[model samples]
Target: MDPSQQKHFAVVDYVIFAVLLAASVAIGLYHALTGGRQRTTREFLMADRSMGCLPVSLSLIASFQSAVAIIGVPAEIYSNGTQYWFLGCAYILGLLIPAHVFIPVLYRLQLSSAYQYLELRFSKPVRVCGTLTFIFQMVIYMGVCVYTPAFALNAVTGFELWAAVLATGLVCTVYTTMGGLKAVIWTDVFQTLVMFAGQLAVIVVGVQQSGGLSEVWRKVQDGDRIAGLDLNPDPTERHTFWTLAVGGVFLMLSLYGVNQAQVQRYLSARSEKEAVRSCYMVFPSLQLALALSCVMGLVMFARYCGEDHHTSFLATSKKDAVVIFFVMDMLQGLPGLPGLFIACLFSAALSTISSALNSLATVTMEDLIKPYFPTMTESRATYLSKALAMSYGLLCLAMSYLTHLMGDSVLQVALKIFGMVGGPILGVFCLGLFFPCANSTGALAGLGTGLAVIFWVGLGSIVTRSSGSTPLPSSCVANRLAGNSTVILQAVYSNVTLSRPSGLKRFYSLSYMWYSGFSCSAVILMGLIVSFLTGPLKEEDVTPGTVYPLMGKLLCFLPEHLKKKLCCVTPLGQTISACQRQPPHQKENNGEAFHRNEELDSCLPEEVSLPLVEQETFV
Candidate 1:
């Protein structure tokens, strides 16, 4: 709390921070002037679907890799040891499935909004439900993303919290409104670099200050900061291999698979191959991001593990602000370093906020608005899209105020929001894409059930303040205390076993990591049950290119005839033969605008209308 402990930025630091915001706006202005002058919904929302793999890949990572991860990951590792690092294991299956499975299905659909697939595969109401669910998820998440950096800075450097929030929101709004998706992607590319540089600077300096890598490693090892694979299978165990790796796959699917933000990037790619490649590219970069944050936590542990300075700040600090406190402490006297890190924090925030605003605009225009006003002029539509982006950006600033009341770690809060809301959204997509028999009624029922269950679990965990398990006390802190070894062991035993919740509380104690997996499973299970009860959809009635043949492939040993009867009535990627037999009147009524376009027939079903945005033929 002392003024002496506060970090003060030099003039160079301010200049660096200013450049980040200024450069972001400049990119927006540049994009606004070129690229059709942001005049069409396609250019504004889909980047004209002309992006290559590189920028799309970087933007994909930046979508969810916000200040929440920047500050939260290190603090998590510091407090809980490196057990969380095992989540990297999830990225393998997480990204691969999206690349090969999700990308192929969604990309071929040529959707402007991811929810459009829901309408094609299910019904219009289902599509609207999915859009609304996504809106709810991102609006809440934008709050955390925008508020995290500002909150952290305020705690350590006396930065004005609300002022920072407004600045971030306004700048992000301006750029997102002006430049649209292109600006959002380009800014993401540039901001991603700044994010890496800032974290690298802190890690490089922290390692040097902590007596270099070897000494730092020795300290962390001695302090028991390096965790081994905890192959615990208990659902209540928070950071076990199963919880993080297994459950984390579902979390990744929720983010990278069905979330509109990432899906928009996948759709914006020049081709399906480019989109898939970008998903693959995300793997290495994501691992690197995780490693950097984890290593920073180790460096922090080495420097301050048992020190009184660590104890003093922690006692007075909000748990989420620990990383900022450490960063400011380490970079205090360095001329431009403090500013660079601040820029890094805001870069992460702005990139995420910008992506969110643009995606929100895209979905609102494509899914919610244009569908109703099919005849809306392109110019008016583009203007409305910009207005939506600006509106959401301002709403995000308001949501940040609500975030101030929450007491959870920023990282946990963000992930919880993803799992609780995103899980159901992912579930609905999975039901529509993989279950040929799933009907609109079933999709609606399953989504409703998944959201209800996940919210109950998520809210209960918060109210009870138990994420099913607590981090074991740090050995560094333990070693410094004067205590009998047996007594300490007994105390830990009591905390782990005796303090465990029971019955309903035990249900609430389910690990937050399992939220997405658990809720997604509920949706699938409920969907199938309801579908069969409501007269399962005939596979022949399903849209082309929507079903992924997951069941058929998984049961490949079955006879071909049996596979068709059990898995699906038609082969994957096959257009409905019935479409060709339909009368001209029927075809027109069903919105079969692409029936004459043979190249599009493979993905475009007879039932769905053309997307409001331009549908270019993929090479």
Candidate 2:
């Protein structure tokens, strides 16, 4: 807190940070100058659909794992203990469902925008609505992502917040516009590595400086900072196993399953298997990222147990800045470490912002613009896409100011934004994919009702200022210094039992973690009801390849006639075989032979088929 304790960057530190920007730009320039030279929308928006699994998987991780996760996750662990780590449990289904379910459907459709499927299954209005909703979510989210590192750096170091924001935003925009999705994906690969390196450095140093891992463990244990499994069923109880593992699935679905940023990556993959493989690979990397963040927080707690190092930032209610403060305090004498961490922070931010800008451009051009102007030239479309990317990049800078006004923790804020907006999008996709009977009217009503309900809950939570359960105590220095290793302080200081809120206030008290699942359920439930009330869509009317036969497969144990009665659809295998029985000329005429590789079909489900009629019905 004193002037003497203020941390300053060394010459080498600045070099490292500068090099990060340079490398990112260089990557962009490389892609821009070579390989179609960003002259077509195919190259600009979808990377020519030739991306491999490795880069796509890494880019997928980099997409959502922004600066908020970099700094905010550590701050969360420092404040609330390791219970937040349980979110790692969510990644299993989060990545799996997207890999197996969402990827195959979207990939097979051979569509440019993920929302195109909305139009295919529902209507053009639903597609436009979904696209706008996604744009809204990403614009707001990228603002937070752009602001987080800059705000943190400005708080702990003397870095200019707006300058940093402008620098990252502009650099990201230039590269994203020039290089297209290839540059964005490859830069993401590089930046993701830097992100991991930065987090790892802090943990290695913090663990070493905090005596050793054992000592660090002892201090955290003594301070009661180690959280056990909390199995609370109360929806308002934040970070419990149920909320994290189960509720987290929907969160994952919202992001990985249906979010445009991730779906774009999936669509860019060379094949459906490659996309699925990339999603599978995300599991371990995500777990590692989660572990590093959680461990960094523990090490920080161990090093500064019972210390006032965090008080200055905590007093101002800048909980997000606490991690930056801890990093500065620990990395003071270390020369390049601080800069490397700063680079790590910005890399995370740039990766996210770039992905958002590109995807925003993709959806804007593909869903919102191209359909309305089907006769637009490719060159004109590419130019507009680049301009859209640049425009959105600039817009995110303005959005950062709005983020600055919010008081919630950055991680919570980011996840809540994902859930509140993304949940409904995921629900619409789910309604169409799993429920063939859900009509366009139902999809629209469901989407509207879901958005309205989630906004009410999300805004209510914000207005009520519903904080998480009491945090772990922040004092253990005396006991550690006095060689009292066995002493265990109470985890939380609260003793009074307060009465729970009732009615609307009780509903408002729901955990932010449950927002995705809760809102998604609202959409599905409302959608089915609305569909039945209005005439449910007949199986024959639903677009082929749009309905995934999820219900028929799930209810496969029933008699064939009974299954048909309930699911109201033909078996997937029968449908695929029936299509395969058609002659090559018939297949060509019908456009039902999108993939000719029998090997690839063996790898994916038989249900992964070409559209029976691609444009006529939908367009």
Candidate 3:
């Protein structure tokens, strides 16, 4: 395998790839041309709230499963071992919390944007702050999403990077802007299948080419690529059981629980039950996605275990480029196979960016623009949404250039964005939902403090890495043909050292996995302390529908006397106490305490209108 030999795509490969792009465009055209109810803002932004659970479920999975995961996860497994797979553990509480806690509140409220809950619960300022934070997070993330696949493919296959970038970015923007949520969801469904098919094809072919499953497993085991549970309590130790499982919970919550990309899908479901069911469907699909990528990494390790391929190509490429190189190398004779894999990569990237563009347009129209222009016509609002989508699409192209300058692995960069920016936003939502005493002042304070702390730590870690920290020893030294090369084996053994980092550097060097958990905790703690100091929100001041019902039950565990101290009487002639004292009949109808009082309904702003279905009930 000469490194200089360029990988060429066959005519068949081009056709296969073209079909994927064409199918995406076709779906967009289908939605765009059929303009009955979809001409309105409601249908354009949220599919008229008529989406089924299946498409929404698949779209939710596609929202987060970007090319970063498809390529970066394998690279992580290949270089650092399979310890990163523990992220699966976090999905348990992750999906459950979103389904049970987030869905009911957000769905029942029937708001266009998830951040709109901030206005209902806290204040207009808090809502604006939340929307702005989300916009920043997604805009930055869209850059990474759009850049990763093109960057990797260019490194290995001589694909024009900027051309690929323009193709994906322009294609996604056009579809999302024209067809809106329906187009995004259906294209995601189509792309998700393509993504799975491509990965599955590569893995199956790679496994057969390398040997059997047992042979690959044996090779991985022999190379020490298999990892066990790392139960270490140290936060600085990266990819430990606690970090992936415990810390990952917060990461998942930030992405799934509060992120508008996912919340928009939840809101699009036809019913609350359908929304929850869609979340449940993500578990198996996501787990399968994780498993497929992990297996592909192990197989690549098996095939190239004793080869110095990194020296051949990886020296000039990103860590993620290694996966593309392996795929190209393995599928060399199989013409259409390479194209399928490349299509898979772009599919992952396109699904994610499309979702981001659509969701960004959604937040802009619903949270930012619509509020200012309350009397704007639906047609004008829909047009503005499309324009916003195009603007973000162009902005994404610019950010993709910035992503080229990034130094870390794509997985770490994406995760860092989720933690550094998303953690504080999640904290704000948590403050409103779980802690009734938190005020808008406390929410704003916590968010600012959280962002500052995370930026300090995140930036410090980047500095530490740039300052020549210890690097992982490469396993590429061994000779594949000779079974084992003693000299290269010795080099691998000698690279291991027992050095430890010290002081503030040690804290900054803490695992990137802990960033979300650490920042979320900091925000929550700071929010509670600031609220208590600056006069906590009264029971009457807290909005009814904004808080989760589970918070009340969780508070029931407190001592009876303590419950009495915390509970308060409301103007509705019902005791609005943390304690459960009222008879079943005396409780608010259907457990909807917020809607029982006409005064509370009056307090809701005129601009904060419910969906048509909910309006009939409320009116």
- By lDDT rank, best first, the candidates go 1, 2, 3
Question: Candidate 1 lDDT, tens digit per residue, 95-213?
Answer: 99998788877776677889877876776788899999999989988998888888888877888889889989999999999999999999999999999999999999999998999
Per-candidate Cα RMSD to the true structure, in Å, reads: 4.9, 6.9, 6.7
List ranges where model 3 is wrong by over 4 Å.
1-3, 35-37, 405-415, 466-498, 555-564, 567-619
Best by TM-score: 1
Q: Quote the RMSD, in angstroms, for model 1.
A: 4.9
Give the Cα-based TM-score of candidate 1 against the true structure.
Answer: 0.91
Q: Looking at model 1, report the run of 10 residues with the lowest lDDT sum.
A: 581-590
lDDT of 2 by residue, 1-619 (tens): 3444456789999899999999999999999999999999888999988999999989998987888888878888887888888999999888878776787678776677888888767767788999999998888888888887888788777777789988898899999999999999999999999999999999999999999989998888888778899998999887899999999899889989888889999888887778888999899999999999999999988888866744455545476677888887788799999999999999999999999999999999887777767778889999999999999988998888777776545546655776699889999999999998887778989999999998888878767766456676787633344444444332222222345667787888898878888878888999999988877766766656677777776777898888878885553322343244222331211234322222222223444443445311211
Q: TM-score for all predictions?
A: 0.91, 0.89, 0.87
In terms of lDDT, the best-performing candidate is: 1
